[model samples]
Target: MKAVLFANTDWYLYNFRRSLAMSLRRQGYDVLLISPPGPYGAKLRALGLRWEPLPMARRSLNPLREAALLWHLVRLLRREQPVLVHGFTIKCAVYGSLAARLAGVPARVNAVAGMGYVFTSSQMKARLLRPVVRGLLRLALGGRGARLILQNADDVALFQQAGLVDPQHIRLIRGSGVNCAQFALATRTRSADDERPRVLLACRLLWDKGLDEFVNAIRQLRLQGCSLHALLAGTPDPGNPATVPEATIRGWVAEGLVTWLGHVDDMAGLLASVDVVVLPSYREGLPRTLVEAAACGLPLITTDVPGCREVVTDDVDGLLVPKGNSEALAHAIRRVLEIPGLAQRLGEAARLKARTQFDEHIVIEHTLEVYAELCDPLAAPAESSP
Candidate 1:
């Protein structure tokens, strides 16, 4: 069987899908990674996976441009003729799934990683344009022709309720699973001079990621005499409507509450210096940062939302706070700070959870099972009479 994977960025393919791609290749499937070419594109080629560069625009919302993109993908789908076309993210899922269908591709799988700002935010676009998008999604995902792969149950439920997907074809594959071996537990090494606890926030600098809330929480903690040092990684997405403004992030740096490192190349090295990992994102699809952090033996603090909740069991592996609530975020930070022993215990539990529930191997095996059932629908076990 041949499979073509379509996404926006090379970095996403490297960070999230590389292990799965390698596993697929080992299973003797002709797997190819297609995306906009970049430095990470070179890395994909080096890993011996076929890399095809398509002019995929990641940011534009223009109708004409999107139509052009869809036509281009349809042309590629016709030429490649892969057995299955797997699409990720919002744009790729929308355009790729439609294109694959138009080109008469055998099977189309849409992986809804996270709903993204468009669906999660209460912006005017979300209010006015969301229904239009959902109508398009129904056309793209509904019925027996394709399967919609949801990363979290909350999203799956929403899509089902909205009639965007058929319940029979909706499959839940929790977050892109992490490789526990690669992110094995590491010992925290800090010097006496670096006595301050290191708190790290690793995600896109988006307002909906709760950056404003995080900043306010940090400021509140500082005002209340907490001396934790903080670092913010990840890039500011210029095209995203929810992106945190550069000037605002700079102002925070000016006040010295947190240090901003624009785009990080060495996430593991950065994770090494931190005592705690925090992602107070308004919503998520099993955040990869939390899984990686837990694997590295760092305690977690995340919002009590769907995907985030899957990674950290509240009061067990990590602390959870109300989404978008600064007071709740600040209080959680303070609680983690007051109890040093809790960090170690939670970190241990998080490592175990990553190994047991979020391991890459388990995810790959389950995914392959789904593919097998897709290939041989008759061989798949029938549901018990109900």
Candidate 2:
């Protein structure tokens, strides 16, 4: 059996789903990855998976370029002619599914990692692009052989309401679950000087991700004499339209209210050191930062949105503030800090939840089930190879 996995960014396929591909390969399936060449292209090849580079661009909405991408994807699908195709992220789900449909692939799986920009936009441009993408989704999912995989119920319902995919075709999986073994908890010991109440925000630094709201909340907290420390991690995403400005971030650092750590890889350790993990993202399929933080037994504070709500159980595992409300965010931050015992209780609850519900094996198993359903029954065995 053979499977072709499609993604718009090479980094995503390399960093996130590489394990899934290798797992499939171990199941006696030949894996072919189709993505635009990226920093991780050589890494993919090193893993012994076949890589096919396509000229895919992220965050670009040029209609002409998009059309060209569709045609190019169709051409690749025809050439590869794999038994099954699996596409990740929104662009790949839409375009790759359509191309696979056109190429007459036996089965296809479209994984909705997150309902990103389109769902969060209000501008005329966003309004114009929304229907076009939705229309493509409808076309991609119109066939009986296609299946849609959603990370969260909210996205599934949204697509259902939009008439994109049938309920029968939707398979719900927890947001690419974290490896519990990898993110172990640490001792809560700290010196008096380092014991100051601190909150950490970890994600791609984007304005629409509620970074501006978070900063504004810190400023509000300072004005109200909250006497807390705010820390920001992650890098500024240059390709994204909503990325926070470098100057604005530097200015926040200058104000002495927040410390910017840029981007560091040791996130599990960072979660252990902080008092709370906060993500005021406008939307998410499920923020991995929150899951990792919970796995490390840290309390969470996030917006009361779809994916955010899934990780946090308001007042149980974490606090849920209104989305885009700086004052509400400040109030929640203050409340969590005032009650010393609350963070401990919340953290304990979060850790239990992570262990019970978000195990990584669940994701791997469900994905493999999809692959099994699409396997070519007549394919020759290794022993029968000529």
Candidate 3:
């Protein structure tokens, strides 16, 4: 059977779900990937996977445009006639599921990675759209063949409380899994001889992501004469209203607060260069940054919110502070860096967690089982072809 996986951006397909698509192909499903046109689209195609660009306006609410986009998807689905349709993120999930229903598709899988901009952002616009999006979620996912995947228990509860999807159809899968083997490093760059501890926060540079808090915490640490270096990875997401301006990032770099390395593709190398990985985001659908850091045997510092909490057990594998509290974040960073042997304990536990829980292979298997529930269960995943 043919499977089509769709997302709002090709970057999401490349960075997050590339493994899933390849795994589906290996299991003898003819896979086709779709997203808005992007540089990463070519990269996906280069991986010997079929990738097509589709027009999707992430923030558009225009009636005619929305109708046209829906028609476009409906037409494509009718033409392609894929048996399985999987969409990532809110907009794509709603749209893909709706189109699948219209086109008479057999199995529809929607992965809402996180609550996304609508539920998380406290801005007036985001708040206004929540009820409407929730309504659409009910319409899209309430169908017989539809399945919803959430990354954490908090989200699962939120959806169930909101009466969105049928509880039976929703599944809790951890964040798109991290490649533990790739991120594994023999030793972190930080050593006793090192002058300063290096901490890295990598994510879309967004205000709600706690970018301001991270900077503020770094400033507070510096004011206390803490000689720790900070590194900011990832790029500002233009699609996100909460995106921080490049000027703001430059200002922080100019102030000697952080070395801004925008969009580092070599994550393993980057992880090796830093002693600690932090994501002070207000919330997450299980931030892969922390998982990758955990896989690298690095201690993580993040907010104690839902998605973040799933990967970290307080004082177990990683440290957690209240969301939006920079002072607490600063103290946590200091505690991890300065307390002798604490970082090692946390890092070792985190590595074990990654290997046992967050490995990509585990996610692939669970996801395929979900697929099996909806489609042909007898279609065994054969030995991976060369």
Each candidate's TM vs. the true structure? 0.94, 0.92, 0.96
Name the TM-score of candidate 3. Answer: 0.96
lDDT of 3 at 173: 90
TM-score of candidate 1 versus the correct structure, residues matched by position:
0.94
Q: Which ten residues in a row have the lowest lDDT in candidate 3?
A: 377-386
Q: What is the lDDT of residue 356 in candidate 2?
A: 77
Please report the candidate that would top TM-score against the real structure.
3
Q: Please give, for residues 322-363, the per-residue lDDT of candidate 3 as tens digits.
A: 998999999999999889999999999999999999999999
The 0-to-1 C-alpha lDDT of every candidate, in the order given, reads: 0.84, 0.83, 0.91
The digit string of per-residue lDDT tens for model 1 on 131-224 reads 7778788888764657878888888888888878789998888878887776674444676797898888999899878888889999999999
Q: Model 2 RMSD to the real structure?
A: 2.8
Across 185-234, the per-residue lDDT of candidate 2 in tens digits comes to: 45554447866877999998987678988999999988888887799998
lDDT of 3: 0.91
User: What's each prediction's clash count?
Assistant: 0, 0, 0
Residue 15's lDDT in candidate 1: 80
After superposing candidate 3, which stretches have Cα over 4 Å from the reference? 185-194, 377-386
Candidate 2 stretches greater than 4 Å from native: 185-193, 376-386
